[model samples]
Target: MEPQWVPSAADIAGARVTDFATFVTARTGESFPDYQSLWQWSVDNVAGFWGALWDYFELGERSGAVLVSTEMPGTKWFPAQQLNYVEQVVRQARTDRPAILGVDEDGSVIELSWAELLGGTAAFARALRELGVGRGDRVAGYLPNIPHAVIAFLATASIGAVWSACGQDYSAQAALDRLGQLEPKVLVTADGYRFGGKTHDKTADIAALRAGLPSLAVTVLVSRIGGTLPDVLAWDELLAAPGGQIDIAPVDFEHPLWVLYSSGTTGKPKGIVHGHGGVLLEHLKAVALQSDIGRDDTFFWYTSPSWMMWNFQVAGLLTGATIVTYDGSPSTPTPDALWAIAARTGATVVGTSPGYVLACAKAGVVPRRDHDLSALRMVGITGSSLPPSSSLWLRDNVGEHIPVASISGGTDVVSAFIGGVRTVPVWPGELSAPYLGVALDAWDEKGHPVRGAVGELVITKPMPSMPVRFWDDEDGSRYHDAYFDMYPGVWRHGDWITVNDHGSITVHGRSDSTLNRHGIRMGSADIYQVVEALPEVAEALVLGIELPEGRYWMPLFVVPAAGVELTDEVKARINTAIRAEVSPRHVPDEIITAPGIPHTRTGKKLEVPLKKLFQGAELSRVVAPTAVDDPALLTWYAQHTPPN
Candidate 1:
């Protein structure tokens, strides 16, 4: 299974950005011989880097100071420029070209041209303004991946309002827990979402959430699941409402553009606030440079509004590329549904997480044999560290020559640390390089940057797109503790990572996800050492579960050898073998056979999502399978819970 097209040596040779001359001269009246000087300058002068970016994009400005704080923990960028983030994106392209393309689960496809998207967004913006939305007002959505989601995001950002969204698959309480923190003025949602031949209605939950939040002024519902919304306003009605041609409101560059949540480790999620100009400028660089998006490209990333990928996808608008949006599971109708869409729409870039690729492989989707993926030139992957085995499998089985980029970055930056580069060679299981203007370093605990060895991943300086503030943290105490407090001005991204000689990055899992059993700190990957190597196991999850007996006990959740039964002897062998390889604490107190491990919609083992489930909480709907499935495993675990 290989890609139909590969860049010839000539093509590769012509794609290099040898110097940062044009961008530098235009933004700063200076030019650099190479990217090294630019990168070093960014590290030495953080504020200058951000200020240059603002001018480079020619961002709209307001009548105040451009930036107020250059100090870490409260640093701000483009403080004086006032402009609506959405307005900048909307006007970036010609009105006749496509801006968004949505294909639903029922095989219905709809396209919105630049004019239509702008006009529709204007109408919705007018609707929000009329509904009393003003600067800094929070607008939230619990929706699926549809045109309306994009419409709502643009509309909210256009009006100088803060947009925050989560997936519709979230339980009523999970949605409430995150959205309530913002005290949003409006909520946009769909009636339901269809997945794996099932429909999950969100209307009732929306009503419940609205009732709980006194600040909610309106509820906008898109007709989904073939149901009518009597009380909620229809998406079309909001888009069609006559308003005297709503004008784009310009505001401060550092003004709040969006409010997103940190998937909480403790009680409630932390609301991270992103700025307008900084986010827009940085994303523009990412879309045009890293993604290699252009006016002729049709781009699609299988994502919901809940994840940061949605933010990344919408940035395609800034590049004048058509964003192909899909609202159902990739595996719906058939495992090849996404490929079919790419083939039909001629999507040049197909972005997804590594977990989805693995699932597709396990499901027997030989992409090269099953369908025509000639149009897809690149595949962007993130959400979890991609192992070398999976990366090679994709090249050998899915598509060769089509670079599989394993990107790593998150909500805080609104971009990637290391991602796809048009000129860089794609290596298996590694990120090609740190994004330009993002000074990245792999540092040991001693604060010295290191390479060819594992350490903490950190940015030695601030970037324009770092979150402006945290909601409810008036004094910025919590915000400080999250990033800066850990290392004084330097951002401590808590991932144990290694940098190769070629400057590629390899994620060794999360610093927090490391298991501590009997004073031994082991990454969850440590368990896979013996488990995956065995002939009888397809996959396994090894973690410490707190028992009612007041002790943390390790549990091995195993997907047994294919076509083999999970007998007591087989389970004993698994336990005995792991303890022998690593330590006894690494062995499981109970061997639970599961059909599949629960995972986030993005494909990361919802260690937290599953922790919620194990604690008797509702499960969020997952669009991709993250683990090997075994139906009887959870039941067996329940039967063996250490009695209180």
Candidate 2:
């Protein structure tokens, strides 16, 4: 593939990765002639690279060894350091710049200065303390992507309490399924949220969620859309309280910072816990070095509280860059809503999903021509594979000079393993390089490394940001089984990837059965739980298929009851149940009547095989007839044409 864009001489000279290379050379007397060599050195000498980062970033006194072990699930990094993520963020606060810029769907803007953000965090931290939220306690947020969510998260982290959140778009049952596992002490919520030019009242959902969580001692309401709830504390009152200087509680390197949920493919979502020091160091390396964001940049990513990108966007504050949060649909009144916000906020780096970019291309919305994008320097795409045409369209429409960086990572680490580097050329439909300190490789089924062909994505070495533990997994059984069951000691991320000889990577869609729709990951079990509840539905199967040109097709197959027929009314009822119970995004594109749903002999749904069949793969290549419960149903599913 030819290069779509290349960095200028000034970009290479001014990049933080280049500066870090020079620093490494000065410290260890090792010369790295290029980005690939630097990455190679970083992976080969993991301890030295991490130790140098600790000193280069001036992260407080490092006492213990940088790496304790090399085992995958048991590997430990910085075993003796005590640090806080909020404290690192506080060090970058400046009086001259705004710490946060919040925008709503109606074009209202809210700016929080560094002093105000610090005050809000202090006051909320005091309130949490008064409510008996101590170290290791969980604080859950049922809120939107507003500044209050950030303030509440900071306050929770400031007190050494673990934070977890679900966006308002999630239903009461869905939210409870994830947050109920935490047994949190406090719940922060809002009355309503706006999306797609409509106001969604979450008051009833909040009441149900609060009722289900018997462990909640306090409920704080933000009053975003204005409603009253009995026995709830007001957000305004919490921030209005007189607060002194912020108190950042020092925590050990392995202390849990926050809990993020997986898609719950098998059952209930898994609570993945990341530590304080690990997140601090990893985000500093990711945000500062790979993305080339710094003090003068305004980082904006269209994200909600449910996605990992929200956390990644908040890490911009750790790098002294301004962060912007949007609390509505990316495309409401126009296709260029995000672009307009970028223009208004003077965003230097803008992150979005491939679906949004393809929509812009389809709508004939030229961002650089319609908006004042003079400040824009880069466009980032993630959450799914970026088609080559979409990447080229971004280069043509957004700006020829702006690099289109397509990053691939997941909620497991909360950071990218392969992403962009400002010094490297941008190739369409491919990521520039594997991140420094990440021993990433493509391996065949037999564990041999492969190049220029699709294979399982594996990480050979341990990253600082790998989860400390699963929330309730005391024996570490679930944690070990999740990543190590397939490759033994290697971390096998459930994605197929092709690593070229040039060290660039092209990510195919997921190899697992997890459903990814519009960049938000949902479990097929979630849909089945809702759809199969109807009396007319006997059995159900759902598939989220990724097609060419950045299109997604999700279809629900249902087996009707003995006396019932599959009709439009039943389909409407199924769709309504899924939307009201699970999530609107998981609503299937089509509902079809099936003679029976195929499953394995062990009773697990054959989701991955059926998904590949609909994606145009042959049945012989995707599945074996002897392994299925019914071979006839597989043929039935393969005969149906996929949606355009």
Candidate 3:
């Protein structure tokens, strides 16, 4: 848990975080002895700290008060702010620089310059207007991770229309479940998408989505795979609407900018809405300063349109950084595809899931020796409890000089709460520091602050990017119950965390799925660390089912590597590994080898849903097909699983 990689003098000198420290020192005339001290000061003076961040990014003009409310769910900031999220993001865009670079699974790349982006957004916005999509209207996208999704979002936000997007890979019902709630007036889709060297046409899925949403007045199709829909406007036609240029709409401070869905594991996904002023300020700090993305950087994070990282990638443009996206399996064709993208694009900050990094390690991928990745200055990681070994492996196999950021946060806030800080050294298996102005803490079950022990991750103070309101949840009943129910006057984020004495935090999976063995609790990450470390296992999932009469059935499902058989020896190795690395109390009652583990489209283990399914919860109530990678895998689980 110590610092795995130390920042060089040049690295520290050039970091935007260091620059912010100097800026804060000059403004407040307070000496932040270190990054830790600066973070403490930021949380302590939340209002002044955020105001300085807004000033640092120069996100937008401020005429009124900076601090308004600090209460949970109702905390308001930037009282008189009048601006647009798209405007702040694309303000520095110019014709000279390439604004977006996208790569698909079929080895195709799409690059758009600033002028093309601006002109396309303008045309698209005009097209939306021509279709009667006006201010406060909803425009949803059942799209892939591509430049078109970005353009559609920019265009929708440009005209003050709220934007929401579902991944193209989502099943028809899942897509309907999410987009149906928003009742978008306009829907955007592509003919299909390619992943893992396979093509999937989403034409039928798109039709199904349109059928379920009665409010849709227009459906625009991007012939990404080269096909025309019967009654839809082509992507090219939308761009040829004869509009002059992008017209940024300056709405009120609290105007709804976009809607993101909660990862509805046990029930229908909640449509979490965020505003322009708040996200603008929060994303500015999270991206520009904490992540050190700027004009000189080409940033890439392998993410789908459904995940919050997609929104974060788009936020990269707020600092004039070139946004690069890859719409394919991270390990397509070979285990080196992600690293190949980094090398080919000359990406300055290469962000991906720890799953990908761990895959490279398991597959013996040494991109530093095999590929030219000299331009990769930082490896930004997230989407799970990043094992310390993965961080060290990335440094050894990719680039030793590169800093590896093991970060955490969630879709609840579109920005990271604990993640990158350029001023701090890359600590193994830990986040750098609390994101500036995020009042984060570790709380016991009774809501007591605790250190060096696992506790619930709670946010004591309101954040600018916290969900303004859940769509259709009038009277704020559901909103309060979603976050504040567990901890009075605080946001219980539902994840178990440990803030150590070393000024870093480690996320111990979701608290709901915490494993209990004879009154001893074990984080799933602990079992995962032991099982996946074995060469035979590729991925693993653990769940403890409690029954009456003090009985428990703990199952460990593992997806073995190709060509590996599920022999007794393999099971013995797994059980022994868990007993050795963790404790005997953590060993599973059974080790089942499965073909694959079901992951959310965003690549999180479907642990809670599967647990519910085992406990006799209805499939529809337990799992949303739209939220998962393969519904077929779940059917297999349901059929093969024994009754409790």
Candidate 4:
């Protein structure tokens, strides 16, 4: 830790604090409180907690009932309410103030004022209506981080249509895997994008995708890279369409707003359906409390259109802050591109995934030391755990006064569990506490709350932001099985973590059979499927094990096919195939050929025990899944493991 980076209180005095204890405290309010009390209040009274959040933000018109219960797992927030998500976001855009800032790879910047954004979005909404894109229709986008992407989403969401998006970098297969499930009516995308000194286009890919999805009516293209446009209508032509005034359509609070997918645990991805009012209200509250977004503030988050961070970042505008969108790799022209953009844009709050920060640290780029970050008041880190080294580096180099808030949560809830506060004390590498209104608890294997030990991270109650349903999941069986089935109605998030004595949390990666490799989240099954498919492999087991660098990396061990010999070429081929089939992150650093893979009594792979074995750590009796075969395989794996 840098000597100059003395631990200190959170940067929360000037911003809002929705709730603390029995009294609801506003930014201008006199008294202040700590994290523990606030967290207790949120967990104790879930309905009132969410209600306070809704009221604090002066949310959508309350046409229906408030809430029915705050009971764990089955809690229904705002039982009856009707509001439009896009209306809440766009409604606050006053004429002159900047609403959106877009910076491309070429260092060219485009700024859109609130008036411009609102008008353009309205026109887009009108064009959609002309195209017969109405309520319940699905409008999908495979685009980059640009103003038009935001506008398209806002417009689609405003009209009560479901908006889904994927980044341009996504492969044709990945795009089809996600978008095909939603079956969007219109496909909105750009011809190409520039990233990592490469010009990549989706023209051919989109053409192929369009052919597969019969429900797609129109193909909308926003030209960025210089190329011949396909049969898709140009963006300018649609924007040039007669600007007709369309009244913002409001809908039920629970009406479907957006549909997104998780990287599949099974073969096909799970399409998570999020609602209108709940997402808007919850996101607004999050931006206000977690990020401390203000009217005068300009917010920036480096995220691809595919990542859920895009949804989290775009929602920052609901707090009336200018959103800065960048459409290229952070290191495209230089390692300092993001900082330079933040400095130039006068961004107050800079948000990025932990991987980006670690990369910046590895590049020897000191942000505050190299760039004029005086305007940067807070730094929000997510997507992965903030390495203690990087956390200290940020605190020291960036300015000790600048709070480094490490937030955690996923698309399932469309909100955060642990995040920042305006006035609470900031701790190093600690997610201060659960966000207000979210009933989060760190429970041991026995399903009892425990402290200072890793356990299953579960949210006792359902929040407003919980996904409405999974697309095409008839009878709600998939939806129920995903969350409630684990604990019989409790929302069990598959995160292995521990809550510290100070109420802060440390995430231990996914509890489910998945690996968080270099911040690229992928299911273990993805690796196993490829590994087992090989002719040289009979069975394969993969696990994400912690490395000395304080991060998790994938390690693979496999049983050789019958009598197949272990050779360097076999290992090379397996690595090569994994990189091609999955993302680059799927390739394990070490691939060892073993005689057999360990399995439990029920024939399921003992991933946890094998993971522990690989790490040279011990655990109590493993949770034997009903699928293991060879118990002796574990002993063999431990002995033949590669030397460190």
Each model's lDDT: 0.71, 0.92, 0.81, 0.75
Residue pairs clashing in model 2 are none
Model 1 lDDT per residue over 1-644, tens place: 22223456664444423222366667677665544455566666666665655665566443454456656666656554557677667557586567888888778889887777777888898889889998889999989888888888888887788899977756565577779988898989888887666777766777777887889878888888776655677887777755344477877778888887775543367787888877887887788766777788899988767677888898998878899888777778887787777777888898876556766766877887766788777888877676666688778776787888678887778788777676666677777767877778888877898888988889876677888888889888888888766678888876768888765677755554445332223345545766778888887776554332124456677888789778998888887776545334457668778776644444455453343344343333312233424434344443444324
Query: Model 4, stretches more than 4 Å misplaced?
Result: 1-12, 18-32, 71-75, 242-246, 518-520, 524-542, 556-608, 623-627, 640-644
lDDT of 4 by residue, 117-192 (tens): 7777888988888899899999999898899999899899888898998877665666777888877889998888
Clashing pairs in 3: none
Displacement of residue 184 (Cα, Å) in model 1 is 1.7
| Root-mean-square deviation of every model | 11.4, 1.0, 10.6, 3.4
Per-residue lDDT over 123-219 for candidate 2, one digit per residue giving the tens place of the 0 to 100 score = 9999999999999999999999999999999999999999999999899998999999999999999999999998999999999999999999999
Which lDDT tens digits does candidate 3 get at residues 1-644?
A: 45877877787789888899999999999998778888889989888888888888776566777767777768777777788888876677766668998888767778888888888988999888889989999999999898999999999999999999977766666677778998899999999888878777778778878889999898999987775567898888778755566888988767998888775543567888888888888888888888888888899988878778899889988888898977778789898898888888888998887656766787988999988887888888776667677778887888778888766777778878888777787787788778888889999978899999988899998888888899999899988998899988999987778997877888765556756443233457656756888999999888876533224578989899989998998899888877644445578889887878999998889888887677666888888888889888988788656435
Best by TM-score: 2
**Error in Å for residue 149 of model 4:** 1.5
With candidate 4 superimposed using the best TM-score fit, by how many Å does residue 312's alpha carbon deviate from the native?
A: 0.6
Give the TM-score of each candidate: 0.77, 0.99, 0.82, 0.90
> Better model by lDDT, 1 or 2?
2
Best by lDDT: 2
